[model samples]
Target chain A: MAPALREFCYWMDRYRRVWRGTVVISVANPLLFLAAMGAGLGKLVDANHSGHLTGTPYLDFLAPGLLAAAAMQTGVIEATFPVFQSARSGGNYPAAAATPMRPVDILGGHLLFVAFRVLLSGLLFLAVVVAFGVVGPARALLAAGPVLLTGMAFAAPLMGWAVGVDRQSRLNGLYRFVVMPLYMFSGTFFPISQLPHWLRSVATCTPLYQGVALTRGAGLGGSHPGATAVHVGYLLALTAAGVWAARRSYTRRLNR
Target chain B: MGDESAGAGVLIEAVGLRKVHTPRGGGEATEAVAGIDFRVHRGEAFGFLGPNGAGKSTTMRMVAAVSPVSGGTLRVLGMDPKTHGPAIRARLGSVPQDDTLDTELTVRENLLVYGRYFGLPRAEIRERATQLLDFARLVDKADEQVEALSGGMRRRLTIARSLVNRPDILLLDEPTTGLDPQARHLLWERLFRLKQEGVTLLLTTHYMDEAEQLCDRLVVMDHGRIVAQGTPRGLIAGHCTREVLELRFDDQEAAAGKIRHLGDRQEKLPDRLLVYADDGEDALKAVHRTGVEPLTALVRRSGLEDVFLTLTGRTLVD
Candidate 1:
């Protein structure tokens, strides 16, 4: 096996001992959104808008968007706090570096584990939304790919930002100022078209908005072919850039 | 005896090795390990004796293949550390200044997890962990969390964890620092046993007694350079007198002048004056004959502290 892959497997074994708390949030986040938005808020949106939401039921429209948003939340959380902890007081990466593992192996293994987490949570969200009868199996399965891509689009960048953090409080400050605002205004709860002219452009430019649009367009109303490619391309570009930045940051921090 | 081991082939050899660390914010680079040459032969205990900031730890990190070498050459287990770090590190065990033990895991779990990092098999890790716990004298605490262990126990566990791979060479950087006297002795005994078992032991320390007890040969460092190198006895024999007579009076400065003729040489400390003598008792008797009536006086054999002070004209701890 490749050394990086072997290191990744070591972390998987390590995660089993701490998986209880994260497993709870991964299963519960989508279910809560399904109940509150798809059932409760869906009724009001359906009643008030006779033909709004492109004639699609609000419940079906919200399911995949919430799934994508939930994935983004899970992925970003994994990238931020855990990355800092491993580098800072946790000292896990340094310990591994002292062994036969290289700096590249440590960085690759951590990102690989985070990717697995994003995919697992995305799958869980898809299952619950499908079980709730919000969307059929075909769209639910297709939505899985876009949902995971959206999560990576957010997670990979957060990882880059997390590695450059010198102070512990910097991460918390980022969550409050940047992450929270993006989560709220990224068209997760409503369409960006409802926002003002300038804000609509700002919302569309953020990664989470593209994530919400992609999953919603794929799962509820089938997307225009050209639009889907643009979202996919934008996310792939962000992931590529984020990986590059993370590699640079980790090398500077650990190889010193 | 040490010369015989040197001809048996070297495990670690460094030629003009160096390390430079640039301060954050683009400040001037501080050279931690200025160029120095040394070698550790197979199955010999070598030591680097120095005060804090004397570049001992920096040198150890380079040999461990963790920190990058900035200049010159370093080979551990016959492989260049700059290029073959993973392969070099795989065959060596390192106990850093700080424990860095996995605090959340039990003592046994810490050993097992570290072994797994080296890609050791589960059955092998399990068996090695059991023996290491006993070797570290933590058999009773094997299942207890590392956080609950005392400072000495934690240090021992860290040393034990490093040994889980049964490494051919062990590098310890001030292994007994901050440990109590009894704890220090216990660790020394364990390290001594490793040496007896023919493991190549390389350690660093500020304590003169630790160097005298554990090292077969050592180098005294000052200002990022090796000022003197030899066995402990050889260093003392070369740089210091055989014995020392210590005299303390109400006024140390005045007494220093008075005691000039009493011994072959003298050094003035804050509260005491050290008179280097071939026979310390004869020097003490001579001090009484001079009618100085010193407040306190004693005689002791010379050690590495004397050797360091003789070479650098400064105290080791200060």
Candidate 2:
């Protein structure tokens, strides 16, 4: 635990210098996205089919879904490039390995750092969601649970996968093929009920869809205890699996 | 191998150490560090002298406890690496062949963060960073990112980072392989100072001059095996003569037949022939007496290069 925190401190020290650039992505960009896509486009959808969105305001429906998706994007972004860079030959992991720190410590530290970023982004994003009247204070507080877990579910696994990636260009493909598709299809913009029946079932199983469902459920008012547990459980399972994979991969690559 | 240092405590020992690396894609298993044995004393500057791919770095990796030894009895800091890697590593400082400085961090932060890896307190690390910055001569660039530094500065920073833990044994693998002559000299001076400070040093290099300069005792490795092990002067004395006379001829094979008897032994290269004798000048006169007016002739004292040539029939650096 101490060694892992040391690795986390290394990232924190680096982050202190680069925090300004991240604010734009984590806070401003998501707000801008809310304004343009939620309020700007919501007015159109609300007027044409006022009751189509379950008799709730379109901004209310879109905000929490967007928050969950943003967390997913943040998770993937945080995990991909930096993880690949460290796993490369002559990169940071080998340097870290030379110290008393073990491979598990290195992996734990970076994942902890990613979780920090996701939490910071989630908090700031939720603050704006409340400021925009998207969700009330109590509901926004509830929504934070899924928002942060959603980030880890994606973060832990993608970090594991990123370690094995051979090329930098493949990360671009991940954003295009994996992340963007989930963002578009996983009930972020509209209800998954609007999709084809078979595709809706597929979306339901995805971690992002679970995230969107939980956040939207919390924002809209409430959900059954059983449904909430399933959402949280699914995300937890993926995160655990991802962390296990990451530890194995890091030890294999570094310890030789 | 250093009989004089036998009374000193052994900090690292390997008996018939072996490392076999099976390729990831299912090829023949390559024996990287074939059966070898050596011991490093507490404060001696030991080295592994060999050409590239001679298993010098492989052996260093094993000593560092980063790579698992396939077969053999190996101990570092009186502990088995397989069971006590972290404990062993806590007392070891490693400077890899390539500079692994964090390009993302500032010059001083490299030391700070690495110190934290060893669980150094923040205040202690800050004080140490100040001293290490001065040591590496990068005080002016302490806040600058590593990417902004020159190759030499980066190498210096790496060495400084390795020292942040105040380690007992410092392992450097080809520490000056890619540096300029001036950079290499400055690094050697820094390393010499560390030796004066009583830090146990273990390094590997393909440069015979580097070995001769830094190492008190070294082992010559070829194709994953130790070909010879001793002090540089001792190996040269045992395998070669007091001096060497180099003669270049247009036809080395024909000229070799004529002057072969002049020296104690001879080594034929594509461009020149080396004549070993007690006195190189006398050997040169003997070659002249043979009427072989070689293209060029030079006489110099024998060194590790000659020792390796005699032992392995190959140069240290290709």
Candidate 3:
């Protein structure tokens, strides 16, 4: 256990060296998105809709959804290629296998790193949200809870998918076919209520849809505690399932 | 001795160990390690002498506790690898066939992280990493990423990483497979020092000279089975005559028919013929007496390669 912790610290420190540029680029993306969609299109929406109850300032309405989208993007990007590279081409897992650390430690450490990165990125995005005046400081801090949950929900299954893929082609297909669609349809940029009924039902079942709902609800000062609990529960369940599947794949691939 | 087996000092023991790998193409299963048994005592260098795909690496992986045993009883330091993998792995250092160093990290960080994996303290890891950098002669490159180093340097760094925990048993799989003569000699010298320090070293290689130089005892494997086993000298003495006279012939027919009666034991290769005898010089003189004009003639002492050919009925090289 001590050794695993040390190894985790080493991995985190190594990540710090390599991810400096990635952190900068990641922080810049949300700010760019906020500027383009929130401020640019937001002004037009504010000018058009004067007294509609469903209409808040466009930037305020878009802020929580953008945070959820950033979390998803961060989670999927970190969870896929890098995990696959470490498992296959990079030989990091094999190196760890030669040590006293078990497969569980390796998987747990990677998930922990992903969780930490998501938290850090989510915090940065929240700061952006606060600067945009979309939410107060109190609500912004509270937003981290749902943002992290959303990130973990996406990361868990993606990590499982990454572990199961031995070749890069399969992972690329997964990203193109499955992840891209989920990102477009999971109500990150618009309310699911605007989609068709069947599509809305489909979105409601997805983990990301639940993530966006919970986060946007919390960020906008709307209270739907029961619904938020259900989303949180689903995310936790997905995390467990993804972890189990990833662990199975890791043991199967590594133990010859 | 209180018990006859008590003083044997067996550090590694395997009984009927077998490993069957399922082929990717849905064909018949390939047995990488067919049931074989051996034991290594403390402070002895053991070698597995075999050609490629002969189960040497598979056996080493099982001994290293990285690969599970399919069927057999195997123990390292009196602990079952299946149940006590972490404990056994903690006490063993392994240099795999391929260098698996973390390329993203510096040479010093590689050692420090590996030491930390063994639960070493931060202060101890720092001190050990420094010493290992010196030992691998990579002190100048300690801050450089491993990918920037040459192959020999990376190999040395891996060797250094293996010693981070100061393991009792060290397993090296083909340590000098692709090294040039100078690099090979440097590695041999380093390993020789480790032997002097009383670390039990186990290795496998295709280089017969490496076996003779580093191994106190060796087993020859072919087609996933142990074909021969003994000390290098003992195996050479038992299986082959003392010397060999190698003869090259430009004309194949004339050499084959003419040199049939030169020695009691002989082998015919594609371009040359080997005459095995107690006295190579005498055998060469006798061949000359036969008036067979050979293109080249040389006398050399027999080694493990001779034992391998004699047991397997084929040369070590394909």
Candidate 4:
């Protein structure tokens, strides 16, 4: 574990050079989404349909959903391009393999950096929403934990997928076919209950919907006691499984 | 091929080492190494001389402990690569055939970051990076991104980065494959200095001149097998005559029929014929005495290329 952390620090030095660009993107992301989706669209919805959006201002209801979605996107981005680049094009993985570092250490270090970015992005998202005066109280910050979890849950599995892929262009199909559809229908923009009951089941089965539910419950303060364990369990199990697959895949692909 | 290193106790020992790569998407497995053996001792520069498909890089990869061995007993620093890969790798440095530097990082930072992979202290790594940059003659370009540098500079920086750990054994696979003559000479000079500093070097090359210049002992590989092994002079002396008379004739059939008895042995190439003799000048005079005026003629010392041609009956690069 210590050696793995040392490997993590190596990337930190490299990441430090381009961190400003990452910070600008991470900090700017939530402000734009909250301004456009929360302020502009929420006012129109609140004016036409007041009580239909869970008895609060629509901005308050939408803030937490966007937070979870932002976290998921941050985690996925961290894992996809960088993981593929490090292993193949960038030649960093082979360099590390030539050293004392093992394939597991490389995978651990990569995932560790991704988790850090997700946490940072999650915190930035929460602060943006709080500064806009949308979140009700201080406890709204509690939602950041589940949001980061949701991000990592998506990140770990996507890392395994990214390293297994040969061409970077194939990732476009993943975004267009899989990620975009989930982002639109996974209760980030609206409540899943508004959809047909059968469509709600499909939305419920996805990880982002659970993330939205967990974060929204934490933000609004009325999460069902029974579903809390279920959501946490689902995300934790997915994270563990994803990490296992990533470890195996990295060992096979990297230790050639 | 149990050829010992040049007077140094063996640091690397192998017997019938083999490698077979299974192509992705479930294709048939292709054998890259066919049970070849060699050894490298401390403070000696050893090499594998072969062409593109001769499995030089595969053998180098196995020695680096990044690629697993398929068969035979192999030891690096007296440790088995199959189980003690990390432990063995921690003691050795590797420069692969291709440059994989993190192009985003500056040259100095590339060295610094690679040192951290070996778990070196930052202050120590910083100190060593300074020395290595000077050694590679890249001190002036320390702050430049690797992507901005030329290919020769990147190759030097890559070699310098591998030395950050002060490793006992250095494995360089075709360190100068794409460089121009000037750049290749500069790199070779730096590598010779490392060999003088007592770093055990294991390099692979198809350039016979490079093998002869940098290697104390080397093995000639063809089609995944060791065809010959010795010092550059030893291999040439054992397989070829003292000198060769190269004659190019526009009329190939006329030269072949007439020059058969001029030298001890004769080889007919597509464009030229090589006449082997203990005294090349005597063979040239004998050719002239036959009254055959050729298109071109020259007498040269036998080299690793002649030895390779003798053992494999094929050109090294072809």
Clashing pairs for model 1 are none
Model 4 lDDT vs. the true structure?
0.87
- lDDT (C-alpha) at residue A237 in model 1: 97
> Which RMSD does model 2 reach against the true structure?
3.0
- Docking level of model 1: medium
lDDT by residue for model 1 (A1-256), tens: 4667766876686687788977787778878878898899889999888443767788887777777778788788889987887776336776777789887777788888888988888887888888899777777788878887888888887887787687888888988888788888887777777889999999999898888888888887668989988999999999889888887777667666
Q: Candidate 3 DockQ category?
A: medium
Ranking by lDDT: 2, 4, 3, 1
**Pairs of residues clashing in candidate 2:** none
Instruction: Report the lDDT of model 2 for residue B98.
Output: 83
Candidate 1 residue lDDT tens string, B1-318: 222333457888889988999876898999988999998888899999998999998899889888889888887877877778888788889887877776777788788778888988889899999899999999999889888999999989888988887888999999998999999999999999999998899999999999999999999998788999999999999988999988889977776677688787888888788999999999999898877888998899999999998888788887
Which candidate model has the greater DockQ, 2 or 4? Answer: 2
lDDT of 1 at B20: 93
TM-score of chain B of each: 0.96, 0.96, 0.95, 0.95
Q: All candidates' TM-scores?
A: 0.91, 0.93, 0.93, 0.94
Off by over 4 Å in 3: A44-53, B1-7, B23-27, B251-254, B285-293
In model 4 chain B, where is the ten-residue run with the lowest total lDDT? B1-10
Summarize candidate 2's per-residue lDDT along A165-250 as a digit string, tens digits.
Answer: 89889999989998999999999999888989899899999899999988888888767889988999999999999999989888
- Chain A TM-score, cand. 3: 0.93
